[model samples]
Target chain A: MTAAPRPAPVAIDDPADPRLAPYTAMRERDLVGRAGRFIVEGEVTLRVMLSARARFGLESVLLAPERLAGLAEALARLPGDVPVYTATKPVMSAITGFPIHRGVLGVGLRGTEAPGAPLPGLPPALAPALVVGLVGLTNHDNVGGLFRNAAAFGADAVLLDAGTCDPLYRKAIRVSAGAALIVPFRQLADADAILAFAARHALEPLALSPGGGETLAALLPPARTLLLLGSEGPGLPPDLMERLRTVRIPMAPEFDSLNVATAGAIALHHLSRSA
Target chain B: MTAAPRPAPVAIDDPADPRLAPYTAMRERDLVGRAGRFIVEGEVTLRVMLSARARFGLESVLLAPERLAGLAEALARLPGDVPVYTATKPVMSAITGFPIHRGVLGVGLRGTEAPGAPLPGLPPALAPALVVGLVGLTNHDNVGGLFRNAAAFGADAVLLDAGTCDPLYRKAIRVSAGAALIVPFRQLADADAILAFAARHALEPLALSPGGGETLAALLPPARTLLLLGSEGPGLPPDLMERLRTVRIPMAPEFDSLNVATAGAIALHHLSRSA
Candidate 1:
């Protein structure tokens, strides 16, 4: 395939320049809304963002000169209109309000057509699939980790309920190894909506709980299935569990539970491969 | 079991009381050193420390009055010689130099008979077991999460090379859901010793790597197996991987890698159960 023409690097000298708004004091700004745009940091995550052009719109990029050479190939794939800014280490740090150790950053727009919609639909190859639905998962690390596990196990998609943290949160993106950029995911209004979606698609919705109906090892994943998880403390809500089948990962009685992310990994591995 | 006589709670009003040394500026002190002792925070971890009476000696405990009732059972198990300090929330926070929302804390001594030795050996029920050996794993969260996973899957023990962080770090203990206290683990001076010990126990040593010799899903775990892991970035040192059988969890090519702890969880699940 012919490479898309690369955009020349635009020099950014001023930290307060309007063009650098998206990258300004990113950690604090991340707490506020980002509209439809999100900051993608690190060379690895930037490449993932650029590659999944259909899922994420490459709005712009700010990079230290040295990082350009390493990302040269991925840069070539960027659309000509996408602006690429280069700055020295100090200047880049000033722009981002933190040391840009990896020296690469990009602004990406979610693929959802409208505000609050789910991500781009899954590909046909993932038609008959296993998906993970997350409910009330506010921890960014866990959100990123579950995406990484979902990607590793070849799960079709991740469905996030309203209470889940943004997958594009800077720390989450880095922790997911950029799987949050590559994986198909959509944020639903609530846990019930995710269950409804699962039903409409002929997928069996399985909620994970410590007191689940069947041990994970003993159950067979249906042709199309959605494994649901909740935050560790409260776990899946009783009402939600009552509406769907529940599965538990057998554990030693002495321990209370595994980290939510670890539990997701084990269950994903079991359903995606073993079952 | 008959309850042992309970120690009367000593009231400590001053955070600077010398008796509160172990709880003083705990986060900072944790970095400097705690001699052979470590801070065990949260009620659950305190319970584990008390239950592990033989492995961990309770030096003293500082608790908020409200937490006393919840911990009464575990507290009863503590020896009469162990000091139990009761304090108000403000006094407790002052002593720890942080908010003590869990309102329970204990200081536990490492059980190794000598410096730099392995942890207490595994119990007989864990014979013919699956274990995890870690090298260069310095992240406290990952270390703790691995212990949690090991506990969930009933892995016999965790062995850490000297480069690995102490699993008893307060954050690690909390993150492990107290598994760090219950799970048997020991620090070896280097990778060579860990490999040697696995051999002495007739365990088939398998190092995990992205470029492993075999896919984890394709392998059958031996009667006794030791899964070796390295830090996420550098992964296992090449020489170490060269010396042992290596395995990789199959994943989508587009994604980078899973969190080291998540990777460990998947591998441990595969070895201990699926295989």
Candidate 2:
């Protein structure tokens, strides 16, 4: 393959520069939510965003001058219109309000073409698919971990209920090892809406519950299956539980429960292996 | 069964009292390492520590008065010599360097009797057992999550290399949801020791690698399998990889990798179910 031409890095020294606004006061803004755009941190995630340009549009990139050389190949792949800003470590830290250890960040616009829709398409091997429907999962770490597991086990997509945390949140994206960027996901109107979507798609909805259901080993998931999971505690609401086929990972007698992410991983592994 | 009589809680009005040394300077001391004693937080872990009395001996209990009534049963079960100290919320926070929102804590000694040894014995159902052997896994969260998954899938034990973080660290204990307290585990002398132990016990050593080995779906673990996991990024050291039967969780193309804990959970779930 021919190498793409290297673009000259645009230097930004002033932390207060208007072009660098997105990099400032990150922690406080992260709390209020990302509004429309989301910050992608670390080199691995930045590369994922670059590769996923068609899905998540790159706004721009801010990196330490030293990292610019290392990311040249990825930077070359970014769209010509996207600007690449380089600054010293101190300048980057001043703008970010913390050390940008990996010294790379990409701001990307959320995918718009398939807004509020499940993945438009999946690879043939990933089909006869397994998908996760998350309800009331407010924890970002769990959300990220679940997406990572979903991607690892060949689950086609993840469907998040309204109460779920933003998959694009920086921490979630980082924790997911950029699976949030790669795995197909969309927010739904509510838990009921997820159930309806599964029904319409002919995807059998299986609710994962701590209370005993069919042992995972005995059950053979259909061609298309939707494994529903709830928040760590309180679990799937009673009303929702009554509506779907419940399945449980038979755990040891007295253990409270596995981490939601770990539980999701086990379930996905089972469904994927069976498929 | 007749109920055992409850032990009266000792009240402490001052956070700085000499008796509260374990509660004070916790964050700093935690960083320095817990000199054989570790903090168990929240109700679930405290209960686990109490039940594991033979493995982890309780040093003391600190609680808010409101929680005392609820824990009467557990307190009655605690050994007669273990002290129970109650303090108001403010005093508890002052002692702990943060809000004791759970209103409870238990200090326990690391089980010394079985140091560097595999779990002595396990129940019949869990016998054809699966155990996790961790190498160079410094992340405490991953350590705790692995223990929790091990417990859920009925794994008999967790064997950690010396490079691994202490499973009894407060964050690990909390993340494990107290599994670190309940699961039998010990720090091995080194990676070589873990491999030797697995061999001596007739435990099949299967190393989990991202570089793609035998697909998990196509492989069945032997009677006593040791699922070996390493730190997420560097993965199992090349030298160690050459020594064990390497296996990989088949993942989607181009995605980074699953979290180490999630990978362990999937592997453990597979071995346990297959058994």
Candidate 3:
């Protein structure tokens, strides 16, 4: 990979400038399809966007000039055509309209792939795969956290259903510490589709349930494993859990609560290494 | 212990009623000491507040009439003089000032115990104890999540330094799924004091860090252990970490991030079992 020329910085004084429109419409971007574009918030995620391993193609960056000196090296990594726009604090606030990400934001293009496209091919020679699957995970924080865990524990990939929120959601990216940008994930129609995808990929499925027949400590990750997690209250569907090998994390009986992400982390750590 | 007679339900139509003062003072109660009282929001926490195991005293309950029928059995457990005030949806919203917890709130008295009082006695004959120690964990969400994990994994108690926030902070309690009330926790002067208390309690101190001398996967839970965790960026003070046995959670190549609460959860799960 070759480094692109550092794009010259441009100054924008008006919040009403059309060039700053993408940075301004964070919430609406989620509602309306982002026209092949996605948003990156905060310096951490911004740096991830500038990294060579980032899946999306960065389109441009909007920054509060104060961050420029600190991000000089990262900014040098921007593609030649990707413009760097600077706005003073007041104008930047008007453009972003929120006190978040500390005046650093990057816009990237998803290319032809939708947020829930087919899985990317695994890194070369990668075997003994371990992955995470999610169903009905609507909460953004949980989704972000799961991705963060997936990255931390070296999961090969993540699989999600339509019921799950997009991991690219800004709040989730922040909560994930930008791991959402690095982890490879695919979204399917729903639980059935996610299971089918796992089966087709030669990964054995394991559903996590509080009523599971086995405890997590007693189970070991299969050669190619896909661990399925559901949102906190109503876990994976009953029949689905019945069909798949199931395991439960032992809890203090009366306090049988664990955040979906926390549960996923413990499971991932247990299965992170080859069994 | 005998049950106190169930308190009579009172109807209050106005938001300005003096009896509703405590409910209206949510934020202020935190800034100014709450005078031996703490608030519990949502039905789950209210139920916990009503539980026989609750450490605090239930002073009164305020509910939207719609929630009354559903909570009847729990109310039967309320003490004799505790008032159950019912307000219409409009009055409820006016009194609460925020649309959270779905119209259910219970005010409980901390009694003579401050939010950070000394530890309660351990259950009789309970041996091989495990606890979580926190330093500079001020984020309510992280603090709440840690408490939730501690409860789920059967952690005997939680110890916090002066830099930490109170677990009873309403937001923290909600995030903990009300486990903040169920689990025993105490606050100390600072990190040094937390270590001092651990020494007094016979809990061998171990700190968690990504740069630790040992990895969690290779470590075993000692008979009695106190696992220490710090906020994300700065982590535990280097000097302190250098002083204690430090362990790390192994991660993928460059993605080294894990949410503090998530980190605490993983460490607690690993050390939860007897070795």
Candidate 4:
């Protein structure tokens, strides 16, 4: 597809092979240090990485021998320069210090940063159709779910406050169904910075709160929308809530609110449909 | 307060005390073997258990001493006969065979089942506003999220095919924000049984598929609606899809579909708003 031949598969039996260093002790290592490199696990996630070669740099790939055949179509799209490593299940498990259930992993460079040029995720640019922002989202799974929704509904980018957890966290990436890699994103300094960026971009910042001026269905979203969602408990800070335009998803009379990610999905879907 | 006292806290020094047996080795035990009993963890979930005492029976509660003050209001609502077990942090961890970070747990009896009574999740009764049915969902977190959305939107009940994971799974209950304890639900034999029950109750069955008859926005749902969601992969079986009305959540071309639970939440919210 890219006029790049499929890379040759290299077999490595030793668990201590230095080529697999980025993947060792995966549970303990964050995998984000050293050139913004990170691990992408599972075949489904790897396919996204393989396809978006311009957005992410392909460092290398490690797969259990049997998985290679299944991944041939995706692997063929890879540039010939990248190395494809293969190992038996036990060796792969020993290297990662966990059971190799998914049997596929890749290392990629986060390529969004172009130094001296304005940052991508926090740019001073024209507004796009949709963007999703997160404030103080500590849970990796929730971060992942939100990204999946943002991408599914065709959000232009995802912005996160420094208080939020890393979207690049391996579990978050896997849980996101790989949307974290495919969808463009940037981390602002804090919640206020997110609002400021939206202001500069002429983007409408809309927060989803349990109590707000209007219902989700009533809002006619503008051309470029910055849909902000907060943590599950102790929601958006009082000061921030006062500053933004707020909307609520009506629920049963005396029930708890929807999970943060689930609410975001409904809101994103509605905005996408309305737009 | 249900004519109940704050249920005096009984200090438990020994981790292996008989009263704490149900919570022992919690990581290994399923906690649903005998008498339909399961463990509810965290202050938020225990509050739901205490509030809906009629739907769930309280066998015993294990708490860390420091958590007692915070739970005073919820504990007061429990029946006077229920024992509130308190242990030091170390003992609590020892009793659970894992770090009891939440420092709160309660054993609840699933009260939906009555002797020879028609199962509540699959009753032959009048149609209600909304119902969610799951087919072949294997993840507990997804199961819990579906229940959370169902309750938030005031769905009448949730029905699970046997292929779906147990909502009573400890993680599911926590993910559900305790909706698993408060919401009415029942497990049926298979996917077909779910469809059959919808038919008998005069509920319109709607399935979510990527390639469906119409977009979600275009659908005019029925008065008594049954929304069905399948696992993330392989979707609802073909025959079931052909037999029922289908709607799709529009996504960007060539992108993967939304997460099953996230998709379900969007559908439930739409149905709730439309109704």
C-alpha lDDT of residue A177 in model 4:
83
Chain B TM-score for each model?
0.91, 0.92, 0.92, 0.92
Q: Rank the candidates by TM-score, best first.
A: 3, 4, 2, 1
Better of 1 and 4 by DockQ: 4
Best by DockQ: 3
lDDT comparing candidate 2 with the true structure: 0.83
lDDT string for model 4 (B1-275, tens) is: 34644547999998878988888888777644544778899988898888852367789998889999998887887778889999987898998888878888998876555644654444355544688899999989889988888888888788899999888888998988888877778889998888887787888899988867878877776778889999988899999899888999998775757878788877887787766
Q: How do the residues A110-169 of candidate 4 rate in per-residue lDDT, one tens digit apiece? A: 665665454444334554468888999999989998888887888878889998988878
Q: Give the runs in model 1 whose Cα sits over 4 Å from its true position.
A: A1-14, A25-28, A52-54, A64-73, A86-104, A114-127, B1-15, B25-28, B52-54, B64-73, B86-104, B114-119, B123-127
Query: Between candidates 2 and 4, which one is better according to DockQ?
Result: 4
Q: Give the poorly placed runs of model 4, Cα more than 4 Å off.
A: A1-7, A31-34, A115-128, B1-7, B115-128
Instruction: State the lDDT of candidate 1 residue by residue for B1-275, as single tens digits.
Output: 97577768998898889998878888798898888889988777877787852357888998988888888877887888889999998998988888878778888887557664444655333367787999999999999999988888888889899999989888998888888887788788888999998877777899988889998878888778889999999999998888789998877665547789888988887787743
- In terms of TM-score, the best-performing candidate is 3
Q: Model 3 off-target regions past 4 Å?
A: A1-7, A96-101, A114-118, A121-126, B1-7, B99-101, B113-118, B121-126
Q: Where is model 4 chain B poorest over a 10-residue stretch in terms of lDDT?
A: B119-128
lDDT of 3 by residue, B199-244 (tens): 8778889899888888897897787888999988799999998799
Q: Which residue pairs in model 4 clash with each other?
A: none
Give each prediction's DockQ, rounded to 2 decimals.
0.69, 0.70, 0.87, 0.74
Report fnat for all candidates as fractions from 0 to 1.
0.95, 0.95, 1.00, 0.90
